[model samples]
Target: MNITALKPFKITWAVLLCTFFSALAHAQENLYIPLETQHNALVLSVSNSHDLNIAYYGKRLNSDKEYSSVLRQYNQTGDYSQVLDAAYTSAGSRNLMEPAISVIHADGNTSLSLKYISHKVEDLDENISQASIKLEDTAYGFNVSLYYKLYKKEDVIEQWSELSHNEKGPVELTKFASGNLYFRDAQYYLTQYHGDWAHEMNPETSLLTHGIKTIDSKLGTRANLFQPSVFMVAMDQPATEDEGTVLFGAMEWSGNFKIDLELDYRDNLRLIAGMNNYASSYKLEKGEIFETPKFLHLLSHNGKGEASRKLHSWAKDYKLLDGNGERLTLLNNWEATYFDFEEKKLFELLKDTKELGVDLFLLDDGWFGNKYPRNNDDAGLGDWQANKRKLPNGVSSLVKEAGENGVKFGIWIEPEMVNPESELYHEHPEWVIKQPKRKEHYFRNQLVLDLSNPKVQDFVFNVVNDLFLENPELAYIKWDCNAVIYNAYSSHLDKQSHLYIDYVKGLYNVLERIRKKYPKVPMMLCSGGGGRVDYAALEYFTEFWPSDNTDPLERIFMQWEYSYFYPAISVANHVTEWGKQPLKFRVDVAMMGKLGFDIVVGELEQKDLQFVQHAVKTYDDIKQIVWQGDLYRLSDPKNTDFASLMYVNEEKDQAVVFNYLVNNRYGQGSKRPVKLGGLDPEKRYRIQEINLYPGTSSYIDSNQVYSGDFLMKIGFNPKVGKGKESVLLKVEAVR
Candidate 1:
């Protein structure tokens, strides 16, 4: 928590300093609670009953009147709705306004009062600032503390709430949101990402109507595709790719969670987000405290791109992904040899793998326990041992050989599942999650292990730990979980257990053990594909496999939206046969993220193979800028015939642009200049072509100098040839 990294450094709000200082000087008053960053401010005032109400929460506060209290000034008299509103609008109570908390005491009562206990400035670091408000209901022996921190440098407010009890008995909570937020107006466009399985993290936006729009996940495993934990609300109309006022929020929990935006009768917006109430009610004993997952909130007058930058900056600064990363170029054996592997075949693939300049080799599924034999999806899961029949030489031998050949080794594992045919499952039938007296359900011919139990957690951890200890050369692990919770009941927990949250906790605990032991090894999270990519899982894994669908055209849309909240280096992109090479579109798409190859290189023709080598060389040349630079989404794939993306370094000294036309268009010979952003306006840049594959045309003349302003504002048109085509260009600032 280096508070300094959270706040922005620019000084646009300096003119309002006098008024802000005057208002802040009086913020010590019992009736006023204010938190301000360099440009944004949140003001709240205590009501007569001691509950805090929202005054303002947007751009910098220039006057006390800007956040004038409505509840404190208005004198309510007649109407029942208005009367009810005046009487029951507290954040900790269950009435008109949404309650941030709802806890049940020993007597089974859910109502409690949260009186203002105290407020203080937690940190005043020049880069970041934080404030805290503590509330307590001594009568019920319950207390809550809300924390707010602003990264003045990034324009982001990270917030969450903690609940604890002092009574001599256990207390249960039904609903505990991070915090309840109030907006002054109801007019907003709610933007959300909703998809299932292969189609994950798809962005969509709609106007907020007069009802509760909720995005939630009840599935035990982050509900990867069903309901994501991030959202944005823009005023008036939805923001374009690069413009408008928007408020964004994302809960950083990889478990069942909820996010709701309610427009009450009063035409104001009420937002509450945190752990989902779906099949979750955590019990807290006396002297124990529970913390809700953090929710990142950001306000941007400059549209989704800027708001997203704030998120990316915070995530990177916090090391949310433990990302010490320049993601490697590798080759995964899944598409090349799924459930099919031998020492010779692996060695044969290694030849092309080395020739293509891939530094890492990932052995996909099929090297495991003999009982199930990994013959297909039906067997060989719960067992972590190498299949003696498939690889008689052993995993250590493979690792040693790969290392000897100048390639690092990684393995794919689905540690959270068990096939009924597995030896472990046969020995411990009680380990699988199933109902007490009902038919067991299965997906991919497998059942989920009851991770909530310590025994199961230990079992999973030991399997991976043994592998790493035995083969010190193991460089990475692709951890995959491929099923949903069709039957989520845990055989190990009590009847009232919160299976959803507990399950994720158990999974996290297992991951923590492995991370502690193998701190340097990078892990990629996958669930079938892109299922568990979020900040929660990011804590343990360095990146994720964004999709099993490697169709580059579709990825133009998926990866485009995916980059909105994540860095390119955190996505595992593979070049499969489809979008096949040279056209080389597949490899070009894969190069946009953590590049890898999924198809067998041996099957390629000589010319295409040569093209593959050239493509890899080109990728290596531009990967630094592609993975580490700020991404500017030029044109969305879905809206038009072409999709364009640009990556620029922070100093704006260099950049790389990617352009693709999914389908060939007719009747047009005109060139269209692609304007780029985030450039040093006065500097001149030498633009050069970076394309290596055939069927592509050079977008710009090589070694041509142009002012950054001219390049960004009146840009160079792409030299796109006929038929589905793409081109890559590199720009370096020059004298």
Candidate 2:
């Protein structure tokens, strides 16, 4: 991947760090990288001992006056030997004493001197500006390039680094952080999300005391619980959805990741993010290059929603593939057939697809490899071939048959793992990640593929990438990683300690290759579920299967949390067999993103099938707005009895709202007025209430015209119904 092509953000100089290099000493030479945009300005500079500090970040400023006062009067600022805290920070050899970069020079020099070298500013596509500084310590024969980007439209600054060694010798990289930021405020608090597979993103907020608060994930596949492992540092006062200053950001990395926020004694705060130094170190040969994942930081004056909007917009610009028109409707055979998959039964599933408007048929986990028949999860991974028993006519035949029936074909594959009993695992026993003299553990009866090995990376890339060139009809793929990598050592890696770092890079390489090879096919990422969904993976994959739990109420929470960082189009929300629940609620909940189904359509009653058919058509009609519109998450499902979400397009001419309530209180038929959000407010709208429940009155008039101002104020009132129920409302601005 060419680093220059990555247009993260455009920058302006709020606190310009004089870009020219003067060959000053590492400790005395202060290098500042300034990125000033209309919404905000971010200035990162190197203080003493090559410590990169976020000198200023927040409101966009016009004055170039350097805020040197933020360095403090009593502190050494950039003077390494003068400040006592410098002993525990920058240029330190001890753990918890994080340095910008730790290198071992061939000259046997004890001190790693990163003296200032040079600087450059370049413009990228989309009006993005990039300012970079080159810092090389010839004593160690190593060079490090720090890059900062500012996007013209958003209040976000992106930071990343590239590390390489000179021709003189080799260097061992024990520790590397993409960037370290400093904020002088002691009152700032840290916020992060923590959860399991189904409960993927739960917000955890706490004040920062005089200590280090780290959110680290070693699960190996971005860890469903702590993704991007992204963290936010905000003032002690809580920021509301639309108000308050909050600095939110993340590292776009997939594998083991870590972010550390330290509050030193001088009342100054520091934040660092990079490859998790979890039993990992890299050896950079002469000319070998290692690029740290991009770290995106955004400060919102209008609050968390603004930050979310900024990140969502940028993610769309970089990752989101344009929705190929209306959102697609796909059918996965997992819930429908489990492992009892056979050609005859698969045809039965596809038979209902076209009639119900599901254009894509996904053959889930059972139709791969002969040695380890995928009847269960214990085997068959890493063997990427058609299972004759499951598809006697071959998988291609099934794809052809599906195409004949008017639906495209998709398949599920776990290429990043191997079953102990599978051929790939037995043939390449050294390919699995395992620590020295330690017991090996497994998740889902599988071990993670050691992508750190160049051969392993090539093999996995060829096997899966071949699946496409070999079968041109395969329109989409659900790439899944079902194992949590516990073993921190890869036998093929020369430096056993470099497993975590090298493995992630190798994974990215494979993904990058496959994406380049098959540029048109869409891919979705799932680790168990929601485990590997982050910006890094987003660069290759189009959608994220956030959870295995398809319950409508559960998704309302899961989707809401992830939408804070990702755009709605990237979330793969499905209407599965959510047991006895109203189809109304299921489809309504599924309306927020790319929708799919997990039910046995062949078994549904005619009425239910007709409902599915109707739901599919309804989705196709309004999906353009739903997938591309700005989302306003309203009401909480965890606390309130009701949950609601609103979607409005860029033109503000169209809108859709999903309002759900479970087990009506006393059957009071209480009418709760829901004023729509994100409308033009001044324009008049013609509202249409689409009622899903057959018997109960939708309570909404068939047709009513009202001004956007009136609708947002007085709102539409729907009579609450008995049992679990949901409603959908569509509004269109009129002349």
Candidate 3:
């Protein structure tokens, strides 16, 4: 019998049946998948022969409408030979552009191709839905799953990727991105934030021409050189606040991250964002899985203002820890006393805290260390014990005293750093991150602890665990990381390339345990000011210190840019003694976020003290509106001499406006009309000026009523003075 010939005939019949079923399934099911929010949708199409592509990502389209035509339109343009607009691009094959995922297989093969396998959509809640698409390499024993979590109400989507391999040998992953997006526009304007230690969150806007623009950080610990977020405005005109199409993306990562914006030859803008592949190439062994950080993006046709509002809503609703909890007004004694305070000074501060109506009293940096006292920043960082010489009675006594005075107590600790002179460092010299036989580098007189070690992770976790264990009433914690990782070598890690990635994972593991142990405690994420301000870290923190530079003028610019993505509830704005601006101006600026005072409140004169008390009361009254409301940027500080912004509650019943005169100009007009937004036009609102000096008259009528339509259209023109003069207005809807 000629069985070989019969075997070929059987194989042909099997192939024919498989092709017939695939065609039948394609004809019966929709090829385009739409992940929709309230008003936006990200439609993905798997109609192509071997690729998954984004068909449309903008305003919501009717589900009954077919998107195959749109996919065909996109496919008709660009280079026909290459996969121009893919949902997730890979290296090799027909893709010549920057790949989202690049890998080297066991046989040193670099060529790879990913094809769609299947997908599923599930509702997480009434406001969030997740859609996951599975793709497999055509030739390799690997699979990649892409995820998009749609925040229905906020109109924001969170995207991430997971890679798993079942290959016999290890696979070297060179480039892996959390999310990839494509936009076809004539012009693209990119707005990103970049700054140094004290001058963080400085925003810059530039036109993206023909090449690639990358924003990244190689700092292993505090990735604050350039924040991993951007706003891309697509229009024929320049970027505007409330009138153009805007795409916003922010990476939820605390360690090294990179955001690449490339304008291809066909004027298509491609954005690839995820953990940085700078010096951290990861390896995946058989049966191992690697997941990228969450990348959040939103599409808005109403302009940057709407984009900012949606992101802020999403952050407060889901991303922030204890998103709806109260952020108490605090008085931190860092700038007031520095590392030179004793127990008596703290007692005095506690008295002032009660007198000034502050909710929490935070003792910053000088209270710890036993064998090596933390008298300064250069010593006793790793030792978490209270300094016996300074405290004499221990931190528990202080916590008790503060509680007796009707004020909560908090303390600061930089757990991820160690001083060479400390007992902990001397005992375990291998815990510090350093290359073998290399001279260790120091920043701010400290070295970063090698968190890649499990023992070190346990120690870091204990730094917080022991504090609450000793003083169960500890109301808050300020976790600070003072230095960036340098000489990035981990003694516990086998491969040097895994140092950065593993360090972040270890940090997160410790944080996760701490959060689980102390879930209700309010903790602030601080790193030499605004160094570690990212979404991933904020998930474990209640708030963040925006910057060490608390000068009101500098904070005006800093907080403005920060409000574009982060909510006001997460901003810890402090009124410090760093600027010559008036006390009222300083307090008003701080009141725009989470209000705090870092100055010597006991030294305030009678008049200033009264004003401080008045401002605190005013902030207490409107804090709910400020923290939980929708923010609208009325004026940009970059274009004008004054900055104005407002927050309106969800009910549209109450609102608060903050106006600051940044710089004075010669012969400038004394009064300017500021247009308001985010209001019900039919309702009548009663406006009153608060936080004014005793017996001082406002620029307008203190208590007046106006229709929302008039307020939005005609606006209110307030009488202004020189620079540093500010105004705070409270508006209430008339019942």
Candidate 4:
């Protein structure tokens, strides 16, 4: 044979095969998958090792540009043999960062190596599209599916993970985070919310170092000691409201949760967020699946302000229950009558409510109980029945009276707690969450019910169901949980470790049922105030009580911090009689969110009453803007003696600005120029001061019309005088 002639032909064929394989590998590496919204993109790609990595997460990129170089760079870290940029970091692998999922397999294997198997993209709706990536363990039957849903218009992305195994034995899940995110080399600053009972949602920013910083809640139920939300800014300098790259997210779980920010030795950062796996190790039997709560996040190139607006828009458009609905202005009798209220006292309060132009009349606590009257926090928590001593005619009569007075009726109930002296507790002691011999601890003289029990769940559901059934005219329900879970035991569950997860699931089950049955009715979630303020509960409830402390000054700081991740429509702010501040100041602060009065309205002087009436009417006119608008925090109270904020509607036609003199400075009576934001710069607007004292003139020239550019750039000065002084300005496009 002609060996030399055959060799050239063989070499030519081999070269063609090598070129084809090389192109195939290059194409696979360049297979960029993007979960994108209108302005943002969470782009992912598969590495040469078949590991999925977040290639880019920020402003949307040009569609024509190839992203293979970016993906290669992201996965090419020199420090470790394996890249630490896994889309969903799993433990028992080469990755040294905090793992998003950690488990002990049936084979007693603590390590897992997940390889990308498949992927799918589906359009859930006009505004939402979901991208899912499937992965499988290299040596086990375990499987995981990572999901990313892009809320297109809101520019927000929600991520979650689902895990399952086909092994014969049960798998122990030690840690299961909802989502994991990795950022390349950058100086990181974290803005997290933390505070105690009355001072919920206090924001504190700190520079991230070469270790893990954790924000978590051990409180079984409220989960408010530290909110499951954070903002991570990746920039060389400190974070600013309107500048830098900001990554913000919230864990949509009402139970105990944790968020960990791990800044690696190379200045890179990894974020792990989800259920707190403290004592709640979940066991997944064969063929069973576990799904983590949705961890919603968004990336903003324009800074934290844009991140907040995007989140608010997403919550209002999709996540929040009845997000588009207008929250009512109500008058609650908590501060007025408390547990001392009777039918007659409520009727008088209803009269005052009607006179003040309040939309709804909420009868707070003390209306329930039979033999052990709920006259105080010490008793009658489990009894949902009307108190024969306080309201002899039951809640139906109050509903009828409220209706007659031209106001809708609402009632407060703590269905998750039971007083030790109550009939329900006496009859079913096993229903309480307590260990067999461990001494039980009580908060507010009440114990938490074991919602992990189906029977207890039924009872709690019936408490709400029966109220609406008995009083068909019931307009609203304020669900309160006054006590945190103690003893950490569930008699109904075989695994005591499953108590926390099971309890939250049961509560969600009951809430889901109630919501499905009464989809239109408004429900407020109040867990000793701001305790249960999480996205998981907001799915079923309309609004939440931000805090028990309604002092106007304190709320200014609290609500400001809260606005970072939550929308104004979801915050139930009330004008209370806690501080010695003026009634106008209180009403103005309350008007910032959902307007409600908790003060004794009947005791108001004529001038104060007139001002109250004016404020209620004013809030109604601007409530839509406040609820559905973009919130721009013009001035942070934390840094200045004066705090200012503004809300501008989507159409750029209507806006409202609020200026508060938090404290009287040494230069009292000085004029402070406050700039406004979120308005159409080219449009001319007319300004008017509302909810003012009868004889007092406006601090700004209300008659003048100015362009939005002037208002935002040059600005106007509010006549500052005494501390606690505030002014509300209404801006309307001059047609």
> Clashes per prediction?
14, 8, 0, 1
TM-score of 1: 0.91
Worst 10 residues of 2 by lDDT: 14-23
For each candidate in the order shown, give its overall lDDT on alpha carbons: 0.76, 0.73, 0.85, 0.83
The C-alpha TM-scores of every prediction are 0.91, 0.88, 0.94, 0.94
Q: How many backbone clashes does candidate 2 have?
A: 8
lDDT of 2 by residue, 1-735 (tens): 766655442222211122211113332355666667777766656665554445576676656555443333333233223222221133533224446567666565445655556668788866588888777766556778888887878766777889887746666677778766766553886778887767777777788888787777877764645554666677646776677778887877887777878776656676777777766766778888888888788888877777887777778776555533334579888888898878988888888778778889888888887988888888888888788888877778888889899999998988888888788987988888877589878887888889989999999898776877778888888888878877677788677777777778899899888878887678888876788877877878888888888888778777877878888888888888774667777888887888898887878777777777877888888887877788776555655667777888999999888777754666633256766678888898887776364444455665677888887787776544565367788888887
> Mind giving the per-residue lDDT tens digits that candidate 1 earns over 472-563?
78888989988777667887788445788788888889988888888768888888777777787787877888878888877778888888
lDDT of 3 by residue, 577-688 (tens): 8898888888999998899999898789888899998889989999999999999998788888788899999999999998888767773433568889888999999888
Q: How many Å off is the CA of 59 in candidate 2?
A: 0.3
Candidate 1: residue 285 lDDT (0-100) = 84
Error of 4 at 66 (Å): 2.5
Q: For model 3, give the 10-residue run with minimal summed lDDT.
A: 72-81
Q: What C-alpha lDDT, on a 0 to 100 scale, does residue 691 get in candidate 1?
A: 53
Cα RMSD to the true fold for all candidates: 8.8, 8.7, 6.9, 6.5
Where does model 3 exceed 4 Å of error? Answer: 1-30, 72-78, 227-230, 233-236, 667-670
Against the true structure, candidate 2 reaches a TM-score of 0.88
Q: On TM-score, who's better, 1 or 3? A: 3
Write out the backbone clash pairs for model 3: none
Shift of residue 176 alpha carbon in model 3, Å: 1.0
